[model samples]
Target: MLTVGLLGALVEARRSLELSKPKTQVQWVDLAAPHGPVDLALRLLGDETPAPPSIDPGLVATWDHIPDHGAVDRMLQQALVNAYGFVVGYTDAMHQVCRWIQVLAHPMTQTTNVRALLVGPTGVGKDLVARTVARLGRRASQPFVAINCATLPRELIVAELFGAEAGAYTGLARRRPGLFQAAADGVLFLDEVSELPLELQPVLLRVLDEHAFRPLGSTTQIAFHAQIISATNRELASLIEGGAMRADLYYRLAHVVVPLPSLAERADDLDLLVRYLWRQVDDSDPPEDIIAEVARRAWPGNIRQLRGVIERAVLLRKTVGSTSSLLDEIKAAPAAQPVPSGTLSELRQRFERDVLVSIVQRCGGNIRDIARELGITQRSVYNLLKRHRIAPGK
Candidate 1:
């Protein structure tokens, strides 16, 4: 079927080829088939080295008070993490996030339509910020609705965001409003915004522009008098440069950009996260030595990894009925692999290769999409394929 289709396309392209490039001789070109994600990753790394750790946006622990991990929204949470990491004289980068909580208190925070963008590493508690805002508002009427763009199906995203009338799509049988309508006078969080399809950007942009959206197949338009909070672990700017996302949509969503520091970067947050996670896992107070032990190792997986370690310790302790090997259990989990040492240029090339491979994986090796996403010419895309030795196509 593919051969027949290609044969037809070749014949159809002949007229243009003859008219435009009558003098240019034609030669058959052999293009390699697209590589799988694993093959691409291996090519990028230039060895059998594993790919970078993927961030899981859905992982969240049960905590109502203040964020113990990446939750740097409130003053109390900051103070809790202040034990070992917070410096008294250090320049406060989080002043904006802290000031936001202070300035936007109660009714205003709940009622206002201010949008925010949270940028940070995975498991940095970006999700908790909206909850914190709602709590600080102290209003139960303001509902909290969240959606992870990475998790949603590409085909159903529009329906998920704007809702749909019954039978709008093949499987959707009943009428339902999307995240915007459901958010109603509350907060609607869009996590992993970069994963959102390019085609949906304009639609979302229209909704933001009008502050209203019509449901799929519905004539009635509803107002979105709610806060739109977007968070992304990936770099949206690069995506914009490559044309994966719209600049207008990014500007609309990022009213106030809050950057959350990674777990390894925040010292005080370790104590806060470990204690909070320990509280959930065990009834007793978290031992200082245990906390210190957790703080010692590298946390590549960030908050998700830290939470898993504590949770695992509890289960392991329960089985043995003794805390003697609790520290052992924590240490038993393997640490993240160390980055290979190299000169600056070499390191940059390595990073570039990794990013290119990631984009390839995301685009499924589509030549045009990869080129557009990289903001480079298609020839450059072919050049990169040759440079990195990455096969094209899915």
Candidate 2:
């Protein structure tokens, strides 16, 4: 059972996700009341109250990033550059994302929920771009929940998504709302969607098509009003070809596909990225020569690797002098390597094992908490533990 404190926190979080935007055709109804679930359930049983005032999405668009228009476009561009610390680059890829956001916010498109897919290599800021787009939408002030699909096990995917009721499965002692319901009036970002299991794909498809889903143990269906922004480092076509993904679901989520350029493809942004990363690591301004030197490398790990390099440099500077040459260190470090290709089943199993192991270690082998967080039954958790040779905590 949820502790009184925990339940209060959940209610507070739900309140924080309520929208500031006026009602639209696809606007989410905040069924949660000011009090706890019992009050909310009672209130929901009453006659539906009239929705709040309606606002034109076009008016909301006034704050959006207009790709190629006028003063608004320029301001949006400047804001993005500042927000990203000018590391996103001035490439066409960035422009395309901005353009897609404008189209996504149109009154016609805004009449329905916007489901966007971001495709690119890992560590290329796909999640960052998605969040930026969400920030530009009418639901900017609402919650922005991001889940790494690649990290979730197949058995827990459904539970992590739609939530579960008490007695839904072994280990679930109380009801819990999933990411979809938690992000009701906002954006729910599913990162590395290419890793999603084929079995759960249809469940996601149903929710996307019908905007409704049943909890793990519930008869009543819940409405899903959050905009879904999915990202993947791998090609969906390849996943579909290998029977690892569903084509129908792909088409639905890919309505607005924004492909991010890899770091190698946008070398021009390296200097800005270095400087930005350096400032984050060390509060002081990075030397121009250091930034220039760091920018000349072929960063195979993309921004994620680059950030690590900068962080290491900061440590080295503290230990040695500020003039520490990192070239030798960079050369000694293993190059960014691609994951070896394998059969879909083999790859999925390995991925699941690794993710489960990591989470188990992080959570200190708390089976109940793991089951709750992963949205799986205790039986599934035990199965994973047995498969991976993990000993559950006492």
Candidate 3:
């Protein structure tokens, strides 16, 4: 049974997701008033005037003030640096993700059965790049199959990928089609592909070369035409250098390499993401101060870990003092940074200056809030601000 509160929460979560879609798309449509569930739903979203009296106030508040992810993406300037701003930093990574796939999904690239390799740390949404392409590309009507190489049994992996005959392996009873056949003319996502066995690399390479593969115990070969997308958390160069992964296979899979940025790399995006994730997990909007606190903290595990923390915070909010616990965790986690070469004194000064600048900007140049938060006097705040060449207020 859906209570009014539960219904409102679901609306907020959906609205958050919908708002993140490409703003270029026409989102709203004119319709006759409240005759069906669809029309009622639109009224709940505030897309129609005079929402039913049953609508919760919280739901109304959602349309009034919610953090929008698409707006954040659009704010980024797409500088076409070498590697598409990868060398410069993914200040525009989230915004540019769709653009990367649009190129590969384009009809011109589709004929080639374009192979793409996504490289990034775990939980950084490496799979999203491939998934998006699959969902929107020319092959959208076909099946999209994803398999994690790490989870496949070493001995049975070959049979699983290229199909096997009744007598191909021990205990085999009947011939079975593999994922490759199922994903034909579609997309095949090989996740955690670094875990693929070294001996199987040659077989995969052969398939890529010939655009065909012979099933185990089969007399004939099957044509291959799937759009292949491979992903890994490990660096291929190091793997090749370590002789763990074949260099030739790496090149074939990396026809178009895409990199996804981690959460810490998206400092400016924190506010929008927090609102997005918060609404995703719960109906209500997250507190603005919590969003600010999140921006100051480090998220080592990227969005995956940040989402877990946010989900827990929402679940525990009914408990007294839970907000403090959230703040405590943020403050306790040391911000992640690369070590710099400098004298001890110089490094300490740099750290202090950085801290002051962050706080000053977050505080909107309010001297009193800055002093209170830092446990410093107003005089010390001004002195530090001057020394760091920071102007008070954002």
Candidate 4:
């Protein structure tokens, strides 16, 4: 019995020593240095090595906060975020959205209708912003109708926006009020505004000009009092250039433009966002280990993607029964290899090229959407296309 006890103690000490040894020999790079997040990530991971001690809980806890601006309209901003569920990050890009939301709170004259546009990458909460704006408006009790223009068939889009009379088309057995008519004295949120068919652009422009739309097979016009709020992942300027959108229509729809940052752009908000999303998926408090792991990733799909992954993690936790095991499972999963490093300019160019390619692929080679997602002017996007020799069609 004495020999067996001694043997068990010796084995435990050996296990502890093995665990204490560094798993990978990696050099540290100041994350706040001039390097981009991608570069910093590469340096941290170094040639198939495990992520270093940077995954510490303390690192996850240290995130920059939005500083107090003495006279900022923080009440309205907080109300929109907390009450209305408009989760924004601390990045300057997202702060700009907050500023715009605050501006939206100002009372508008009865005669002057509000028209707002939200532009950003897909799933960056454009719809959330539009809905929140509607809730914030004077017509909060009235209907807030939302439509995805892209999902509608081109033949049905016009009818959907401006209702059709009975027997107006093959499918029309009865007259139905359009979205604009339904949202009377309220808000009409047109998500994917760029997808509004080119043939119907003039009709929309006319409605914006006169606040009236003509139903199919009807000579009389129906008056519309609904405010218009649009969200899109595409650029109107490029769309206009391509003759798929109208400049006049763009002028009417974009009275106020608010752009949101991608999730990766606001890395500091990862912990906050993760914690918020975890509570949404589970009743328990957010586990620090999961938050740390999530922070280390590059969430290309932005907030929507982050939320989805966390929800899945929460689902897995039910079976795994502990945060540590879930994290171990995540670590065991295969991850993509990093791009090789080159000179500084080369790295920048490579990153730029990669971003352009990725956006183009995701958008199916729509330059307008690419420009919008990259937050660059269409002209700059064209210039990059020329420099990188990337054809817009793939």
Candidate whose TM-score is highest = 4
Error of 3 at 230 (Å): 1.0
Q: Using lDDT as the measure, what is the rank order of every candidate, best first?
A: 3, 4, 2, 1
For candidate 1, write residues 177-251 as lDDT tens digits: 788888887778888987888888888898888989999888888887877778998767656755678889999
Judged by whole-model lDDT over C-alpha atoms, candidate 3 comes out at 0.68
Task: Give me the runs in candidate 3 sitting further than 4 Å from their true place.
Answer: 1-90, 318-321, 338-394
For residue 389, what is the lDDT in candidate 4?
97
Off by over 4 Å in 2: 1-78, 81-86, 105-110, 323-325, 331-394
Stronger candidate by TM-score (1 vs 3)? 3
- Candidate 3 or 4, higher TM-score? 4
Residue pairs with backbone overlap in model 2:
none
Which ten residues in a row are the worst by lDDT in model 4?
33-42
**How good is model 2 by TM-score?**
0.62
lDDT of 2 by residue, 1-394 (tens): 1111212232322232232122211221223322211211101111133323552333333112334333322332233453332344445555555456555544455458767888878888887776765665667778989999878867777788889999888889999898888887888899988778778889889988898998888899998787888989875764564456889999999888887777766665566567667766686766666676665556767888888888888887878876556756655555434445797579667877888887887788888878776656677788778877777762
- With a 3 Å backbone cut-off (N, CA, C), the pairs that clash in candidate 4 are none
Q: Which of the two candidates, 1 or 2, achieves a greater lDDT against the reference?
A: 2
Q: In angstroms, give how far residue 191 of model 3 lies from its true place.
A: 1.2
Write one digit per residue (lDDT tens) for candidate 4, span 1-394. 1111111232332233234323322221333211111112112122244444545533321101224321122322232254345665445666666556545543572227768889888878988877766665566778989999899878787788888999989977999778888889888889998988778888999999998999877888999998888888975765676467888998899888887777756776777678667767687756777887777766667788778778878887787775665677556644423435687478657877897888989988887888788655678778888989999889
Q: How many clashes (backbone atoms < 3 Å, residues ≥3 apart in a chain or on different chains) does model 2 have?
A: 0
